[model samples]
Target: MLVITVDLVPSGYEPMRRTIATMSISNISELAEVSDYQIEATETSNPLAGTPPRTVRCLIREHARAQSVWALVARASDEIMKADSAEL
Candidate 1:
């Protein structure tokens, strides 16, 4: 069995964290084809500017039964990376 874990650093705003989590959950649900994925808010810290920063953890299974989950994670990561590159 395998596992995929994604860590998110909130953009100095609680709402951003929630937004990202919601997007992630929806993306996982639609692409992963696994119904057992979970996302959790872990901790928060104050940033120098803007709102406080938050951290989130997403857990996804990567077993044979969850092949789609693995594919979804790969796709999501690819999209994120592409966006980051575009920003650079």
Candidate 2:
């Protein structure tokens, strides 16, 4: 079993991370071989941000791989991209 943590940089406009994954996604689907790994997101509020506290989201992913995970993810991303492009 392996764990892949995606840490996102905070945006200037907002103190919290975006809802969608912000990591450079060239190949990141094998960790989710059909969404293989279980995804967990924890949010924390920062009081110093302002009157309306800003909530931050942290994403964590875990998976098991018998072979190279990179290759798996790359293949999956390719398939997804192809399907997505076809919609246009």
User: How much lDDT does each candidate structure score?
Assistant: 0.41, 0.36
Per-residue C-alpha lDDT of model 1 across residues 4-70, encoded as one tens digit per residue: 4434557667555432222243333444434444443322333454434454445544313345655
Poorly placed runs, candidate 2 (over 4 Å):
1-14, 21-66, 84-88
Collision pairs in model 2: 30-73, 32-35, 32-36, 33-36
How many clashes (backbone N, Cα, C below 3 Å) per candidate?
0, 4
Please give each candidate's TM-score: 0.27, 0.30
Q: Give stretches of model 1 more than 4 Å off.
A: 1-23, 27-67, 84-88
Error (Å) of candidate 1 at residue 52 is: 15
Q: Model 2 over residues 1-88: C-alpha lDDT tens digits?
A: 3333444457655567454322122224554443343222222333564323222222223334455768545544443333312110
